[model samples]
Target chain A: MSRTLSNPPSVELLSAVSTFLINDIAPQVNGQSAFHIKVACNILNIVAREIENGADLNESVCEALSNILSDQKTGSDEAQDLQSLKAELSEVIKNDQIKNNAELLDALKMLTLKQLAIDNPKYSGYHQALKSNER
Target chain B: MNAPTDTLIDNSLSGYLERLQTCCRKHFGSQVEVQNLSKLSGGASAETRRFILSDPNKRSSSAVILRTSSIQQGAEFSTSISKDCEAQIQKLCRSKGVPVPEIYFCLEEDDQLGEGYAMSCVEGETIPPKILRKDQYATARENMTDQCAQILANIHKIKPNDTTISLEDQSPLIQLEKLEQLYRQYNQLSPIFELAFKFLYKNAPKKHEITLVHGDFRNGNLVVNEQGIKSVLDWELCHWGDPIEDLGWLCVNAWCFGSELPVGGFGSMDALLERYSYYSGQQVDLEQVKYWQLFGTLRWGIICLFQLNCFLTGLNRSLELAAIGRRVSEVEIDLINLMEAL
Candidate 1:
């Protein structure tokens, strides 16, 4: 990839704006406006994290999905993308086609953990799951 | 009660005030003034407005809350009971020693206020963060588990046959089917939800004693004071189901609000079940509660998706709703953890 002319990277720029909203603007607001400002800051942070790690995480998710669905016969040849693979997995699960498959469960867990890593790493469930994984 | 400031009562709200004044007169049987009529935030299924109803002749005023259905013609997405039924349920619960706001009147179609009810506004802090963390509510945090258990017991004592209002019978499998249908309507793929559905199906417990479940009974729906929970609010999602569902739904991690304690961030599951067993006169099966906890997790995830759809479809373009879309992952992780425990 060719280097684009940029002093501050996208992640850094987002973090700077989020800091401005939280440190400077949030203290001045109250009630619903204050709450919305907090949410706005959170959204900015999520965007920054996604920009920094989303592609790599999604690539891992794709690999896990492929490992889980490799042996299972897909419905059609067109169902090869990430979205289709996920939809296929959902369908199979709903139909009880894949029951008590340890590999499938592990894959799903990894996929959800990766998603939570980007969406909300601070969520209590994420931390609990991480602790349980370590154990 | 103080009257609303001039700036608080904008020009757009004058018509609402006039109509509310008329409604107050009919209910109070006197010329009552509706002051400080302001909309309360955070309810998605219904509109809640707080106001001071003053009878000029008596020179006395009291805080009153008006709740009306927010559902419009093309936006029938809520699974809540009717506003009239909700009011009746509250009245019934109050009669059964449950701490709920006193219902004053249910709005009729003739009132032109749509479907709603007026009730006495119970004064207390309803925010979960305040109730869980504030020093004033430290006692409340201590007593909440028992208080909630007692309230749930009282609420569950009311049978469907006891009320004139029609309540849906949502057994475990029936509720799961409805949830799956609702999720399918969104046309979104969520493998974690699917896995949850599968787990719930495989582990579906035998139908226990069917009783009225406060479908949305959780932290945010409670009003707490220094002593403890003063009133239980938001009975819009009440239905007939397994009594344990209430206990399980209360333990959902999302309602914990970043707190480690499971039961609404105030107490442990053992304490809740112990208190509930004493009040309800039956030993609750912990395993059953776990099943519903998993169900509640998936239910919250689907609701987050529903909110995101509302934002995506332009029905409600709220920053809060857009942010809630990202919260589905939190529920996903919670589901994974709960399933692992199972």
Candidate 2:
């Protein structure tokens, strides 16, 4: 604290920085900062980018996913049953995986992703990144 | 000084410029040239500015991109980045034919510049905000599904140690253990989500096979051009984990195109699955993809809480940051609804 007060950012310091760059540093840069602070700002932007707009992205997706899920699940009691199924699958996964049913969990995951995509149809990459019908 | 819990953070131009000058001098030699610390059109991880660096010999060099970590990247800096991992994996992935810029340097030590890296900047369109303008882009956007899958296959094909590369990441037991630890780290949550979390937590896959996971794969993270994908950017969250994590993340709701179609907002899920199946020679499992998709939204919701907490800790304050901190509600709703409908 004492050191900071003793050497505050005075007019001279600012001028010296500006002048030194204009004369000595500017010539070398032709005037540019290589690892620029814009880089730092960019870091902030990355954070800000997600912050400012991520929810809209989420809502748009959820609404979209809902539409798809309705289409694929295809029944009046489907949504209600999915909740029960999710729980049962969770139990089956936690309790035990018969070596014979090793492929079952994978099948569940495929179903979950498909269900998710149905709600958020824009998430087409689910299929793009998978095997065609293993689920 | 403002209250610590403020969400908005604004940068000082002078401070930015000084840091720029010093960073340049230290890295590029005495002739430090930093320009445009001013904001660029599109950025999500940190504030970015378009700028150039020149040599002492008067021969001009390619422009460089500087990236720093921001609170917006995620509330938990640790969550959004492992700079060491990012630097190493990027270099490795690029060598393995994954398209990305050639990183010049990653500064772990911040003598002058903050934490960031210098890379040869490649010009391409990644801004979802702008990419929608072209009719060609809209019509051909579906192609991104196959294109992205092919690139992911190239990445997946790179056998890090041979063993972990073949399997999808969800070894149910480990996933359950990790999620328990992770959820515990985020103190506040609704009871509904707690139940949902418990259900998913209990259900994680038991297979221990590992693979490369680009934890946040999505359309916004991809850079593209007329022909196809130019570069796949933002590698900080990548790790050795279930391959499904990346697959699920890629297909999440947020990156949809203008149309309501699924893959990158361009096509049907079935078509995307077919393309991936064609390339990988593996049977397509809709069920596994669905499981990952659910987990992806769940994970995203938890991550939003971490970001919101950053504001509480005074790491950064910006309206954008505040807004992001607020967005957790939507993801929470997504998680709850999905679990309910599951």
Candidate 3:
């Protein structure tokens, strides 16, 4: 898969920029401008992390969602893409067909955990969830 | 008085100050002076500015807050009531012995300061982290959960029949339906939101006696000091609904601001509920509160989504709103945790 280019370099560049903003630029600015700079750095950090982990993350999410859709009695037996699979899951949940089902809850937990892992890994709840699951 | 810097004083603020001076003359005297007119950092809903109004001849002065709706963040979401309506509600809440600031003047059309009112400024810390973590507020933090409960109980006592301000008497089920519709309007799908919507829809609380709910009853919104809560602020979302809605919103983990405490980063839910039942003379329903807690979390998450949508849709191009949109995932985490516990 390594041709003539790669993404890590770009992500590293973003990280460098975020580090510069946090260490150098933020301490100099004041008020709303400083706040915006901090948020910009945070957004950069999230984007960089996403670029690093997005593919594996999406694949795992698709697998979890597919597992939920294939539940025996209440599940849909269609082979579909990630978007359609997600749409189907949303429909069944919205229609109250799988409301509070144990399998649905598990699927939801996985999906949420995956989301937090990429979206906000440092969130205290995410860490707490990870800790509790470890035991 | 600190003089405003030449660079700091801009055109619109100068014009706004002139208009405020004109408005003040009617209450004070023709020679009324407004000093230290500066912006205060707070919520995006309203523009809060602090100033001192003095009449040298009378030798009297008062610190007042002049609040106006920001042209950018104007009521794009459904929850926000008009500033005039908020002023009316605050007046009624004050009359009924609720801990809210005193409204001094409601801006008229001739005043041209847009939609907002002036009120007596109550001094205290409104920043959530400062109250949650700072040593200066140690005593206040210890007593806050009880104070919040008493405040919520007092707020719930405001009768719909007594106030001229219109408050919506909608059921929790109806509110959930409205939220679903609003979520659809965003036209972006999140499996997390979908799952949350499903859970909340299936377990929406039954309607109780509809009373005034301080729609933003949480930590950062409370004005606290060494004594305790000074006043409850931000009535923009106040409405006539299930009073338990307020209790649930107060305990939402987002309002907890990363603190382990369930009630506004201050104390336990059991303590809050116990005090609320005692103060209001009604037994609390823990199950109903839990249902609303999930609803409130999703509701706050949807609000983050809406703020992001506002930025994306070019309605209000604000960095803060965009960053807040990123916080939806945080709520997703909280929602999952709450559901697992249930």
Candidate 3 residue A99 C-alpha distance from true site, Å = 8.2
Candidate 1, residue B162: lDDT: 77
Q: Estimate each model's TM-score.
A: 0.93, 0.58, 0.91
**TM-score ranking of the models:** 1, 3, 2
lDDT of 3 at B208: 84
* Alpha carbon lDDT of each predicted model: 0.83, 0.54, 0.79
After best superposition, candidate 2 residue A110: deviation in angstroms?
26
Residue B334 lDDT, candidate 2, scale 0-100: 48
- Give the lDDT of residue B188 in candidate 3: 64
Model 2 chain A poorest 10 in a row by lDDT: A30-39
Please give the TM-score that candidate 1 achieves against the real structure.
Answer: 0.93
Superposition error at B325 for model 3 (Å)? 3.4
All-Cα superposition RMSD per candidate? 3.4, 15.7, 3.8
Task: List chain A TM-scores, every candidate, in order.
Answer: 0.86, 0.30, 0.81
lDDT digits (tens) for residues A1-135 of candidate 1: 212258687777888988888889989967767778878888998888888788788778877786676655444444366787788878877777774566676678888888988899889988888888898
The TM-score obtained by model 2 is 0.58
Which regions of candidate 1 fall more than 4 Å away from where they truly are?
A1-5, A71-79, B1-14, B29-31, B42-44, B71-76
- Greater-lDDT candidate between 1 and 2: 1
Report the CAPRI category for model 1: medium
